[model samples]
Target: MRPAIIRKPAEQSVTPNWDDSAAARAAFSWQAQAGELCGLPGGGLNLAYEAVDRHAQGRRRQHVALRLLDRNGGRCDISYARLSSLSNRFANVLKGLGVQPGERLFVLCGRGLELYLGVLGGLKLGCVVCPLFSAFGPEPIETRLRIGEGSVLLTSEALYRRKVAGIRERLPQLRQVLLYEDNGGAVDTPPGTLSLAQLLAEASDDFAITPTTADTPALLHFTSGTTGTPKGALHVHGAALTHLVTGKYALDLHPDDIYWCSADPGWVTGTSYGILAPLLLGVTSVVDSGEFDAERWYSILETQGVSVWYTAPTAIRMLMKAGAELARRHRFPRLRFIASVGEPLNPEAVWWGQDVLGLPIHDNWWQTETGGIMLANTLAMPIKPGSMGKPLPGVEAAIVSRDEQGGLILLGDETVGELALKQPWPALFRGYLGQEERYRRCFVGDWYLSGDLARRDADGYYWFVGRSDDVIKSAGHLIGPFEVESALLEHPAVAEAAVIGLPDALLGETVKAFVSLKSGIEPSAALHDELLGHGRKRLGAAVAPKALAFLPDLPRTRSGKLMRRLLKARELGLPEGDTSTLENPR
Candidate 1:
């Protein structure tokens, strides 16, 4: 089948923030975007002020900033004014506790008012805010805190008792442990922890933000490697520009749009788009405090009246597995634009969104290191189902392979190579914490090597191949697992697929795929051969999978990326390093 092109010229009525792609790229500048944010009172830039304080002090003061939903069908709305005041009080609380500027303040909590206030307040106080997922076990939590040298921690009372209490003595640098109030009501505070509610209540909400420059270390997000300790990616306050610009151009966020980014702040997507971008754009963002249920998600879209939604491919696949009949049960008339990240979305999921949900799901590409969206199938552009659309305005991406002298040899259109970004982009990570040499290896001269394999078409659309390390070298042919996986996904029986290369006598690496079937589809000899033959027919003999196996589910990271390396390691009796981020590893 020829690649599907989804163009929704009449999909939306409102004029997008960017309409003319060519003109937007030609007339874009980071300096011009700087003027969009309201900096501090004097001569400095602060993310918190731009995201909440500026709006609270202006006409959108009473506008809903965060619409928080609890697991048990509860709703709470916090206006910008309320957000600013509460964050101000928390900032004062941080100040009173002697947490100074540039100090690392780690937040470990779930979706609620405290998570929002903790991040914004830490930014307001000029501290480098680092947020950890509340679902993380104690070891991963302790590792990040120790690596980042966390001085203050804000978490829930239950989370503290469960995950943090055991690791408290292990982290001497964590001097201040703050516990926030949860919906379950107050419990006795731990011995070393302070109650965030009591602290906020006593603290004054009239604190002023100290002046800070654009280079001020504002946020720290830890990214773990497959075989080592997690590396902290340090981002500055200036990264807010990337978030703002990408939200406008890539996500098409407008002030009146009710947006929902179904990602947790533990991952970069949740922090960048879910929190900063939407807030900086002055849009009402919905935060759901429950785990992913297909029915609940559809309900949220309908009831919340969400206009813009940014989610992940894993979530989309799960929804696809839930069947279209369940989707038709709910209506999402308000949903105008939908985008997916965290992985290369399979084309089937994109078409499923169009056929069932009334809109095609746009796919975008970026990484933890890049910090913001580099490529996207934007609202104004025609969606090439599996393509990562085109480069964002002001972003220059190239397909390049390394030369013998360790220099970049730029490849032409339709050539698969490492995706390189010519940078000076605001959202690029400044450095990996305590790993300067490792950080330096990520770039060659001016281009940041993304380690992702991709091909650029003549029309400037980018299609993801696979990770450089994950690419299979089989019989002198370099094959991308994504292509094989995508082809497998087109089959009616396949729900999810992960392709890997295994050692073989004839070929250096042979393609092997592990798959999960749709609901009520069982794995048998006949079905297995049919799927294998389907891959061979679609992808051809050389690129197709020679071996196939059925799995109950595919393994993925906590952030929803398929962990192909883990699958390979388990299959080959290799060490499965750092299974902490794996979701319920066997």
Candidate 2:
């Protein structure tokens, strides 16, 4: 929120080309060069080739493409050459199965090498790739299959049985199902399923990459809607280029940096950071295939020599509770930066990270519609606590007016309102697939209105308040959930907390909190009253929770977003839909 901090000297080494905006824009992506910027191109460049083949052609094949650690603790170091060949073989497998270009290929695998290849392979074949979380159950999986109209489903043998087995009969468009893991005992494959290994063995590992434009549909990411069905967010090849640019600035990922982004690949963060950004830049990124353990995560940094580390605020908070001494023994001399997305990184977490991790944690913000990071604190920029920093160079972010009609209107400086983008960048989604009306509603005139509420200081730094839906209203006064949650987090006993609005006959809706206590803390009536008293003293009674439920954990998305809607649904005894994204729904 202060005056713009001058770029640090070290930041210059990782800066993107700013020579000619016209030339940089011209070289945005294959789709832009192919004429998709003005109108749809007849042929487009494949993003897979752009990320893999283009790097290979430029003699960057020797660079480490991926450093993968399996669930069983096995390690695999893959280069550009290996990644390209693997993708080719996978593309050939799809080709042999009669899967044509422009068809849909759905991938349902966890973090690892196979998931990477399947995604790139589908893109190389000019097919739309839909990546789903491995934790999703049959209902969520079925919803995607119905909407995606997937021609082929690729998954590990474990997830295939646990999730897809029961729903395979209902998916009419799913022609082929390929299992990546080698299961000696064959499970039922619905008559059309085939062995993925066998198919790849029969096909040549030299499938030709398809040529396309930047506008070609490369990805179909589904976002959960408050209404009926989930909407499919359509992204083109041009949007993929943003990852390469974002990686350099936001994440500070370099060739020697053993970067690790804790975000799962199923979410937008995973797609952007976990895969595309690192690969495009030829960085040696670490893939932690196992579960999250405070000691183990610290060990990975110490042992693997992770230079740039990125994770969520929730994980950082969890690590904070594990104490500083657990990491004191390790020497992470190579570690340079720490970054977070998912939610606003609390100032406390940022301070603790600097005190213990030797670097300040930078917070960034973006959405599913934006293919890459829009607002961020770059390595070159000076640290600003509790701010989402300025809009990235190519992005134009602004604060607009919230009118009486409950719609976004244009606003000037220092005013709090809805955040909107003045122009669509290369990474921005074209539209919601098959929902023209809904897509049209997202844009207000020239501005693309993001549903988040924020305020910009006189210096242009954007400060996040909360999501519009999560805003609390009481007695004609408006309050943000972050303000209240941040207050609650200050209490030593409160490990985590989520605030939501509940129906109140007197005040339309009153604030209610579901709290999780720190380790060894018990739920006591005295403690509840103490927390309420603390809230009254710290944040005023107007923002205090009217009712509090001490829970073990909050229902959150895999990306670590508190799912207040799900909690509200449960409190009202309403049927909760597609909690597939929920990490701990109970």
Top TM-score: which candidate number? 1
Supply candidate 1's per-residue lDDT for 442: 94
Which sections of candidate 2 miss by over 4 Å? 1-44, 182-190, 225-227, 402-408
Off by over 4 Å in 1: 2-6
Model 1 C-alpha lDDT per residue in residues 1-586, reported as the tens digit of each score: 5466556556576887877456667888889988898778897899999999999999999999999999999999999999999999999999999999999999898988889989999999999999888899999999899999999999998899889999899999989988876875665787988888888889998878978888989999987546688889999998989999999999999889999999999788999998999999999999999999999999999999999999999999999999999999998888999999999998888889888898889999998889899999988877888898899988999999998999999999999999999988988999999999999999999999998999999989999999989999999999999999999999999999999999999999999999999999999999999999999999899999999999998888888888999999999999888877877577
Q: Specify the poorest-scoring 10-residue window by lDDT in model 2.
A: 33-42
Q: Residue 195 CA error for candidate 2 (Å)?
A: 1.6
Write model 2 residue lDDT over 118-233, tens digit each, in one string: 89999888898998888888888898888889889988888888899889889988888998663334444445677776777687878777766778888988875343577888
